[model samples]
Target: MSRFITIKDIARKLDISVSTVSRALRDTYDVNRETREKVLAMANALNYRPNFNATGLVNRSSHNLAVILPFVTNYYFSAVITGIQEVAYQQDYNIILHITNDSPERERAIIKNLAASNLDGLLVAISSDADACAHFQQVIDSGVPIVFFDRVPDAIKTSKVMQDDYNGAFDAVEHLIGRGYQKIAHIGGPQGLGFTRKRKKGFLDALAKHGLPVNEEWIIHSGFSREDGEADALKLLKQKKRPDAIFAANDRKAIGALMALKKSGIKIGAQMGIIGFTNDPASTIVSPTLSTIAEPAFEIGKRSCELLLKHISKRNFIPEEVILPGTLIERESTLR
Candidate 1:
């Protein structure tokens, strides 16, 4: 069997002490620049790779992070993962992904089992049905730092990063109003999620600001799936007084609304308008396109990872909340 090259092998080849090679490889400030450069060159030539297991054994740090999310099939979640991976790669940390499929039971199982993984930290976007975050508290108390993003839970006291859902929803509604759509409706996500509540509040506030009637029936709460959107849209369109425009919580729901409206023989962008949050690629692909709010999903992921790293490095670091703004992208779906 071929043995892997180690720092000691590079040190011997360069006639230097193993400690010197170790410090040089880590780019420690105490090492001489020339010596560090020479050590790096020799290590590269010898294909020397540090044994992370040994390092972890000595330092009690696994240098690995866990990212638990509802799912990654959507553009927003996938893009967020990309952002997180980029930062993890740069920081020489490994990321372990766990998908809960939006099941609270599955999320609980994952969190409950994370204590044995020796993870340095955790970044999560909790499942919609997660009513309690006591499992997360157990993980935190066990010394694994956690930072949440996007679909964070209110019950958790950890750091969180997310887009400005309230402002995004407000902007989507106000834009629809500006386009001359009076009877506006909203298709929101599960009411339990923090972002969902924020978006709903924004929608309600915007309607009140414009003196529009608050039809409780017009605000439908459901899952964040296109199918959920379609179902809610059908219910609203079948009403005695149908809405003239719809503002969906996310692009997937918006596209679903479009499908329902098109099926009902309603002329989109003319007799009716549709707007959504999260500029998913499907938004542009759907016929007539989708006018919506573009969230900083990637930025949210990066910031969450950064915050978790901070907590990992400084155990006493106080938790913080970071909210990034979303931009409105006007498209053919809402054009007059």
Candidate 2:
């Protein structure tokens, strides 16, 4: 009389035990291939759909992963989500996305009140202003596995996946030097984040390697936005000593710099060279085509999901730190 077909109905029709039918449906090692095939055939004929809720109750796993990030609309974050989807789809897992809108308070609130029973794992990209890791640590203490990606926290002992920020920034700066730009300035993000610090270190080290004096005034740290870049560039233009080249933290900032320079009638690449990190598509669309260092964003996402699954399967899994490389893409912006 039931509209929906259940595994019990298949078991009754096939003259098999309910336990055997369950094992066959699950494709357990103990269930022979012939039995599994028969169960599948019967399930198909009856149009029997799995009740994940019921199964989750018995298996103690929701098979859902949470992804918490700053902004979902950004190109880099969107690309990362694509890669995460590829793996999650293949593995029959679901993702619950949470966007904090770059708010640290919102981020903490989300993690602090997360229900452990509804999720198997978590993937995080902490906010730029997130200064505390206690909320994250609390989740881990509650027995949920977490894998941090991109904007990760330094205080937590967890798995992290990221592109090599230090080397990428080094490459961007060295490229400017190679193009015969002697005086260089760096427009970076917030001073507290790890990636920001790493990128700044790379810029400084590259300058030091080329025997250039470290101009404290030439380096500016602010929010990671196009407007921030424009403001930073305008300040630099007003300086009694302006840099001949600028290496922006990300493409958005670099694009803003380009706009500022163009308005001031400073010919890009000829008078003031520009390079940026993260090969955002806008880099190519902007006039003079901004050159940039491309981070392996997709790879970072895929690897983060893969690593989180390991933690989910094994309670004793050790934490890992993955640093992938970045490639420099040359364009008209950096050409002299």
Per-residue lDDT of 1-336 in model 2, one digit per residue for the tens?
467676778899899998888888767789999989998899889876554543552356678999999997878999898889889888778999999998999998888677778989999999998888898898998899999999999999999999999999999999999999999999999998999999999999999999988898999999988999999999999999989999999999999999999999999999999999988888989999999999888898899999999998788999999999999999999899
RMSD of each: 2.6, 2.6
Q: Which stretches of candidate 1 lie over 4 Å from their true place?
A: 1-51, 115-117
CA lDDT of every candidate: 0.89, 0.91
Question: Which candidate number would show the highest lDDT if scored against the true structure?
Answer: 2
Report how far residue 280 has shifted in candidate 1, in Å: 0.9
**Model 1, range 179-200, lDDT digits (tens) per residue?**
9999999999988888999999
Worst 10 residues of 1 by lDDT: 49-58
Off by over 4 Å in 2: 1-51
Which pairs, if any, clash in model 1?
none
